[model samples]
Target: MASIHIPTLMLALLSGFAMLGVQLWAAQRSRLRYLDLAVWTWGSWTLLAGFAMLTARVVVPVWVSALLGNGLIALGIVFYNEAIHRHVLGRALPRWMWWSAPTVAWALTAWMLTWPLAVRTSAISLVFALLLCPAILVLLGPGWRGESSLRAVGLTLVAAAASLLLRSVHALTNPEEYRDLMQSSLGQGLTFLFSFICLIGAGFGFVLANFERIARRMEEMASTDGLTGCLNRMTADALLRHELERGRREGTPLAFVLLDLDHFKDVNDCHGHHAGDDALRAFAAEVRARLRASDVVGRWGGEEFGLVLPATDGPGAARLVEQIREAVATLRLCDGDGHDFTLTVSAGIAVAEPGGQLTADQLFMRADRALYRAKDGGRNNVQLHDSGWELGMESPAA
Candidate 1:
């Protein structure tokens, strides 16, 4: 209960500010400067503000300081959560979640108002701690894709918790000592708050850095395919829709092409499974080599590929797929046998009509049907679709 040390609190405030400055300086140098950078930068500044609040706590009574400290901590957590949601959560938090801030504030106000002045302060901190338990567990929970910042947030909360526990334990043993300490200039409260700021401020700094790292990682995971390192099926569909919309809006044509490797199952059968994987990888590489910078290619599924050709019409897409097919046919997978193995791909292309309604699922389906028709007519051929047609072939397993 000893009063917070004014000089130490000032030092903590300045140190926290210095940490914020460093965090900002480093944030600017990072490659991806967006909401993530802003969140981390703001988090550092909040820690400094929280430190200032703790410093102000010493001049006020222990009960007042505790309330203020709790409020500041809650605000800091709110900012941290916002950073996570902006960078990590693909969606926004619901309005119901907005109540947590004022709830913590109310809890702090109640705690301060209910402090017993005549007798000793009970272990009331326990109740607030228990209240915060759910939030703390949320940060450390399995669902948190916010791996980088979660530990830092947890550490900050834990530091505040330790201070509370320390003060509570000390107060129960010696009431007079606790009162005298609260009255003194460097009583338990100042020591506790100062210690809390140093430990938790540093923790917040770590959390900010992690927020950036985790956000970047999340983006990579969302947009890039794990196996081939190209765009994933989800991203490919999204990109197709985006490009189609753009083309429609600008009165331009965008091409959709579907490609399927012929006799791919035989390749898996003739060689070991690992060799089939290598062949698929080699086929992807060969196909990629024939593509232009404006084209986007992604594996639609096992033995299937989806291509998006922005600004290209149906004929252009056919020519591109034909080039890819020819390039793939020329590729020879060599083995120890005297004869070399060859691979071929059949392709289908379609152009989006101006003012035509097309959904991604429907577009892919049309192109895919064309691809199967080409496969049925003859392997390694391009079938360009003018209208929807069924090939009557069974869909392959993904």
Candidate 2:
């Protein structure tokens, strides 16, 4: 077998470093998804350092080469897993997990420093495979929530882990033939090749995932209100029409709630437009907090918000809007001067009966008419278009 030279591994390490730079540049140029970029960049550095240390194994003490090289490579695996979790789950992993995994793996590497070279290498391979478990768990847990690139990331990692396990078992079974892994050996060459392939595959997968996320976020921003973080009028109007069609076709009830802040202009006049924006944000927060996940809330127009609740009847939507109205009353907003004040909302609810062929505008107009009645009867109340005065429940405190 031709001996695997140190310069060859150095070239691979250099390649990884170059890719990391390219990924960093792409991240900045696009101005999106720095988390994956940062995580994978660390992974590249760890692998590069590990390979550099491995190349010096001939000059260094056996224990130092084994400990540092194996420890760093294991750490690279852990970080790749962390990147997967971040992109897929949109959350930070527990501090103990990524923080302590490499430490613990390094401890294991240290303990195995005195063992036979083949045995130690095999044991470390097993540790590397185990370190990949976190990423595997995330990828396999549930659906990707519409991001399909996550599946590729997960599968690529799974293949890498399987390859590691196979090498571990092979080394353990034939210790005599694979005793010196640092030398030009077929086993070592294969391991290095697999590591390089995994680095390329998973790295590209991460880039693709981040790009997909950026596109989706851009779409969201386009369709969303900047201040309130709710759907904008255009998107809300389109959604109402879509839901109306579905309710008509599938025989499901759909309700729309139109909400206006009582005396919103007064707050603006007294506290400035900034305070008005704050109140609008506060109102949107209450709407989000009190509504069901299936319910869609949006900024319909100036000082007016709309809600689309699928599978909801008139009374059910009434209770939801009433709860939202109460929640709004409790919201406290601070003006530029740091003084806090509360706001109340007037809500009007209209329901499209199952199998009804009402248009989006029809539903909107009905809810809007009820809103005028709530304004006329007095503010801080929920009025239903279908039930008229009977369902015109005014807040006792109002």
Highest TM-score among the candidates is held by which one? 2
TM-score for each prediction? 0.46, 0.73
Clashing pairs in 1: 1-181, 1-182, 2-181, 2-182, 2-187, 2-188, 3-187, 4-190
Give the best candidate by lDDT.
2
Segments in model 1 whose C-alpha atoms lie over 4 Å from true places: 1-211, 334-340, 388-398
Query: What lDDT does model 1 reach?
Result: 0.65
Worst 10 residues of 1 by lDDT: 117-126
Question: What would the per-residue lDDT of candidate 2 be over residues 259-365, giving only the tens digit for each residue?
Answer: 99998888998899998998888788878988788889999888999999998998889888888887788777889999888898888888999967677898998
Residue 103 local lDDT, model 1: 65
Clashes of 1: 8
Q: Give the count of colliding residue pairs in each prediction.
A: 8, 2
